[model samples]
Target: MLGSISLDKTTRRVSLRAKALMIFSILLAPGCLGSDEEIDVFYGEDIVPPRATPDFVLFDQNGDPVAFNDYLGDVVVVAFLFTRCPDVCPQVSANMAWIGNELGDNLGTEVHLLSITVDPWYDNSSVMQNYAYDRGLEWPHLSSDLETMEPIWRSFDVGLETYANDTDGDGTVDGFDLCPDTPEGEQTDADGCGVETQQSEGDVQTMHHPLYYIDHTTGTIIVDRAGNQRVYWGDFVWNADMVLDDIMALVEESA
Candidate 1:
């Protein structure tokens, strides 16, 4: 059900290796290639030859076990985010909410959404519930212990790492340092020690820093009805209308 690209002068193979090159081309010229007729190309990075998405079981905000395979029949938008992410994560979630509003009743029917946490250590069930509730996003925000979650992160190609680097010589790592450029050797509060769990405060800046950040891939992946990854939209460059078109195309294809 993935959309096709119309290229008047370009020839490219459809594979993961080719995806990078296509992304470059997409950035330069986003739509059709022909001069006379405009053809529809995916606004998001297209996975030419779609790859099967890995399946996993993770805990939702309710601490309920949800398996990826269980949602195979629906077109799922899988977004990787952390509640502690300063900016990008909330933007992606808001975009998802817009898409949900556009979907109307179809939000939970033919199409579905998932928000998986990159920082599972601090994004536990209660924290995730608060995140969803505060944002009015009624989708699964999932997490698990590192042992159970690391494999899932790898499967999804999430580039994840945690480190303690205090650039200002503060006792806290940069990830947890609210005042990253604090004057060197100046005594500060325990802000760098990390929070037990971060809640969704209105201001991203006011949120407590984690002991260390779970820096990982940032984006949403569209999975087709058969559990294959079809397209990817970077968190920062989401086009809600185009994303909806892709979802409807997949849903209509199944119909």
Candidate 2:
């Protein structure tokens, strides 16, 4: 009788487990657990709002002028970065490279990647060309003088700041930023592009930081064929698959 009771208890447990799984499946099924509006609220459908890629004229690594209007019909991924960035900039570039590789031939044809350097003072055409060659980047690397580059950077909301420091500065910070005037121990944007917006007054403050980096409220922006900003992926850490999904989504929407 003891053995029979043990078997019955085991059977009851299994039955409970099966019931739990069934309930879980029902909860996960579309239109079962929550309404469409509820799902949208939970998942955040407007995270990335589409925006237009503003028109700009910048010289590619080859010294040829490339304009936004020239690539009007193609899907473009624009990234603002500098070759001298020690942290996030390289990661962002690598992420773009991965997206291009994942897309294969679709990159040059269906999509194009544009990288604009914030350090135009040092990242001239030759410097950009060498950096692109070393990284095996097939995309365009564009830059211009500070005077010319400022307007472009401002258009994208990138801020810039410069400081003077020589404590082990040695002119180059690991080939990331060539700003020898940059002060030692000064905090900068993650990408080393420039300074932050809305500076706070300190108890003791002296110099002001110039804005150079883009304030990318939306980590990624998707511009559709109709020239309308259609998708905005705000603060979304990008990956190849996710980018592909975004492209496919836009393509399908256009179709």
| Top TM-score model | 1
- Poorly placed runs, candidate 2 (over 4 Å): 1-49, 165-220, 229-236
Expressed as tens digits, the lDDT of each residue in 1-255 for candidate 1 is 223333321122223224544544574484534455433345687775577888899999999999999998999999999897777888888888888877766788899999999887799999999999999988999999989888877766678888767776756677666666666545555564222233234423323344566577657888889998888888777887678766766665565
lDDT of 2 by residue, 99-213 (tens): 7766665677777778888787678999899888988887889998889887766655455664443333433232334333444555443223223322334323333332332
Q: Which stretches of model 1 miss by more than 4 angstroms?
A: 1-41, 169-172, 175-208
Clashes of 1: 0
- Per-residue lDDT, model 2, residue 50, is 33
TM-score of 1: 0.73
RMSD of each: 10.2, 14.9
Q: Pick by lDDT: which candidate is best?
A: 1
lDDT of candidate 1? 0.74
Error of 1 at 44 (Å): 0.8
lDDT of 2 at 69: 70
**After TM-score superposition, what is the CA distance of residue 241 in candidate 2 from its true location, in Å?**
1.9
